[model samples]
Target: MPKVSVKVKWGKEMYPDVEVNTDDEPVVFKAQIFALTGVQPERQKVVCKGVTLRDDSWANFKLSNNALVLVMGSKEEDVPAAPVEQTRFVEDMNESELATALDLPEGLINLGNTCYMNATVQCLKTVPELKNALLGYDPSSGGGTAGGLTSALSETMRALESGGAGACAAAAARLLNALHAAAPRLAERGAGGQLAQQDASECWTEIVRALRMRLTVAPEPNSKSLIEQYFGGTLDVELVCSEADEPPTRSNETFLQLSCFISQDVKYLQSGLRSKMAEQITKMSETLGRDAVYTKTSKISRLPAYLTVQFVRFYYKEKESINAKILKDVKFPLELDVYELCSPELQERLTPMRNKFKELEDASVEKSLNAKNKSHGDSKKENKKRSIVPYWFENDVGSNNSGYYRLQAVLTHRGRSSSSGHYVAWVARGDAWLRCDDDTVSPVTEEEVLKLSGGGDWHCAYLLLYGPKILEVPEEEEEPMVTDVTEGPAGNPPTALA
Candidate 1:
């Protein structure tokens, strides 16, 4: 029995004038078709004039005694159109299926199912061996195209021959062999296969182009452009840190710590300069009277340097009660002018200090002028006047035991008092010095002495006295006063006799 079968229709029109014979026994005929056609003759039925016709239907016909035949119609004109005989071979075989039918592996079918069998066959036909096989012509025999069965047989032979050698190899090896066998042939004539290859290559090219573009494009800079573009930037000043001579790490924390350490060191230096200045001022104070104003200029102009000097103006204020004794309890305004005389070297060193002082003085003068103008424009009557006096004490009086002395002075503002008595007393105890004549000395008057001991402003006759020491006097029954004396000629006191 054949492994495959096909059914073909035969009718009156196919042999209209042929004789019929049905006397002999019919011979059963069987045929094989391509396995892909799926045709079977045994399963088919033929109808004639709305009646089913079997082999027995022609049993009574007679012509030649040994021949057997059947008529499909009574007359030729009554015959139906010749039954169409469609060849079932190669109807639905895809390239892979076709390859398999010829005993070839799936991988060898390069055109896949994307191309028609004819086109795929054409592609395969480009290869000498495959073309010879497809045309049923032996390449060695040098024959032309053969019939259908011969073509199929040739193809089967070719598939077996090409694939047989690699059957024992790994599956991948067999697949690679098949692909190599089919690729060249397909490349020449498989338009669909070639299109797919072109499309794949184009896709890969686009992907590589995209990746290259991404790599070549420049990235944006990370830092701020304003400083770089305009100022030509700089790194912040940083201190060098060492660990046994190792260079410092340039991190934010290290930089901050270094800055703090430097600031503290500066403060310490400033404090030392102040102490030294205080010490020098004390030694200078011993040589001058308490009320004598001494002036010393800065040796250096900058802060730490400028601070090392004597007689920098220091001022403070205190309130006085109405009933307080002015001679004993009143506080005085004191002023000491320290001329800042800088040595050339010191001037250069203290230039920054001088600049700062100039700035402060200008600001202060402007403020004072504005205040004065405002006060003048005010309609309210002025009852009291106030003034600020800069003053400093001799070093001996300072509590620091540095021989720094305290000096006191008065800022007296006279105003109308409603009381009958024309006097006010304001005094308090702290430090005191007297200003008299060209020379400043301690006072001799008991009242003045008491006021100095009590400490503050006092009212008294203004007398200019130039003296270096206080006069010592014993306690007496009467208050001491200078008695007026008469003068005669020759600047002599008048004689009692004459």
Candidate 2:
């Protein structure tokens, strides 16, 4: 729920105006009043006119324009405490139980209308590699200021590192500090306790930029930064015109994300990417001395381990002064295969890894069928499947294997325009999904995550982050027997011009 500002008057005294979210329960409202008047919430009953509002929630109620509300309750009341029976502290619990109790990745509080920042942080937090990289960063590692970005961001990441242990009470505060220090206008909140609605991708881009500027740890020794280490890829764009006499013009570009442009012919995400990669347009050709039709095509020169894909759904409408949405239903896959999207050389290099994935998948399917058919002997045979590839690539800078990726994190929006919408993050923690909407975090299912494909203006996927598909390698494989030809025949040498 969006935050709102309101005023409260008690008897002859007027308390300072405080901001509260209208979507929250009335108990939270009472807690706010308790801070101002030093009154216990359990003993307080808020009244508007002759009606006493229920303390459960503030539904169907408006608190706009600093509306005044009357309160009728004692300043303080003494209450008895329940008797204690059993108690278990961290000192007594094992590591697993302690971790469950702490739950390291806690939800961030929405400060006023900072949902965009909260959502962005939540989505990025899903990346354990990023968190581990941040944990390696120290404030004393580098000096000087890069737009005052490093100091604030490093501090924020430090706070986030141990969030589950309750060591940090203000993850949102640290993030807002970093954001304001880096880009003031992006973190600004206007009047009415409402912020200028921001694009989640824009915010996401800026946050990544900040981290790139600060945390310089690389996955590999010579790699640039963790941003490039995890999310960087190179694109090979080629331009060819039918009227031009010379060979096709080719160039390279770096990208952190690929935009999938929706079109009439785009029925799904793969097709949308295809439409963006290859397009025909009219351009003047110097060799032909006339405007000619040109076809521009792009392919991946390098595939990063973690891939980011943004749906090009919002565009600026100068007349409307807002980014209007396309609202098209773009279907994306849970496990994506990008083997076809790579350059010829890269595709050839990736073939071995692709074959290993196929072998594992085939073995898995066969095992499932054998179990259903009560073929335990065949199941054991299928269990002898051999792995030929490593879980990760030797050089972690590029794709691990098979050009395959699993959907990891999704950032979503819930309005028609980018400037006036709510942003949330759906993150995958192993097999479970967490839908993080500002301070309200709930468990969701994969089916619910798939429904965010943008059709009817509900929360739809705006940006997707994919991680490399990890494969287990077997210890050994069947090797052919080597025969000594010299032993077979006295005059025979091992393959001497045979």
Candidate 3:
């Protein structure tokens, strides 16, 4: 099915150029309508050609181009609403009111060349656990630069969550001040006495370090902090000697984020990550007591709830005296499966949950297909036979049950070097995305998000955030569908509406 532009008539208001993707469930279309009309999906009654839209299927209607959709439902608060003439369109609303009415997250104001910090802040805020931990952090108990940084960050996050433009700037200004105080190099001034552009990845690392030092909300009993529990992953490392006949040395190392090293052969994020897992290094062997070549192998021993992947695109160029960037297009997936990248022990632990996820996904597809053919009563009966997939671990809130993750946020840069580029944050909001570009936040699509994967002078993905992929089994009982095509002019054409 193709996407079609339809005119939506809600009361006397006629909204033109409304896009409907017939391939997706009607609920997704309802979400788009809700974004425009402020009517909840459950409350909406979209009718076309005498057929009321169903959440499960669109088999009953053959909607063509310029088809008219009559949306008949008032917002819950506006059930006893007055005339439609009194209603103001989104275009007519003021800036603050528009942001409020659209339910957009506040964007950070760039204080001079601080887009890097702003972009990093927006990306990190996509993790709810981290935000909650920051909000609950006590700066008084914490000490040193980390404490002040954490305090400023908590305040900045609070303002952003507050959904007010004014507060966002004030809080962001304080965060910038805190950053300058903590790291003077970040606030380095140029010869012209202007604040220089900083590296967004470096800023992200420093912020994560500060949060790990503070924000003491342990997800599990013996865990360090919320940052450690949610963002931390373990790598099982093995070093094999090439010359000596010594046993392989094994060790476990923890990491908050993974570094993806981009080489000529690395054309995808997975390949870059895999390349870093095994490499040759010169080290002294205990058996030989001399320098020897060793093959270092590493595999993921533990998976985190939220995984951060930094693209190592910048390299120090001594000739240019700058951090040059690799503008290679490294493709990444929306849904990433890392079962093969994990150690045998961890893979064994993840198999059950991964199997359950596959089962649930297949069942969901089957249910969606069956709903188009089955009667409403049959659909309701099928709900009773549904099974639940139990959590993989005792404390699974901030942990990955299966070795799968979905892309949540992407931090991108748009220049030749990290120190002289514009940074932006593209964060997932339900099925849509929000592009946070220094106090200018706007809606974007997943396609647009994927296009950020570097090739040219466009915004290239520098940092990627992946969250645990959790699948939910949907209930069969859907909202009541209302049928009324006779009220609209487009539906009541020369031929009778089927």
The lDDT of each candidate is 0.23, 0.67, 0.77
lDDT (tens digit, per residue) of candidate 1 on 1-498: 112122223442232232222221111221011011112222324333344434223333223322222222232235478744444355565454344344422211211111112112222222222223233343343212212223233343355336332211122222222222333232232333221221111221222222222211012324222111111111222223221232322322100000001112222222323332222111122323233222222232111100111111111223532322222221111221112322354345334433434565686588677765666535243333322111101111100111111122221211111111121111111232222210011222223433422122323211111101111122331112211111111211111110
Q: How many backbone clashes does candidate 2 have?
A: 1
Candidate 2, 407-491: lDDT as tens digits: 9899999899987878899888766677777645666668889999988878888899887776654446422222221121122
Best by TM-score: 3
| Candidate 2 segments whose C-alpha is farther than 4 A from its true place | 1-104, 142-161, 164-169, 189-194, 218-223, 281-284, 288-293, 372-392, 396-398, 474-498
- Which is the leading candidate under lDDT? 3
| Per-residue C-alpha lDDT of model 3 across residues 152-209, encoded as one tens digit per residue | 8988888887736655655676687677767878978777645689999889988888
Candidate 2: give the clashing pairs: 104-164
RMSD of each: 56.4, 14.1, 20.7
Off by over 4 Å in 3: 1-101, 218-223, 381-392, 395-397, 474-498
Model 1: CA > 4 A from native: 1-342, 372-498
TM-score versus the correct structure, for each prediction: 0.13, 0.70, 0.73
Residue pairs clashing, model 3: none
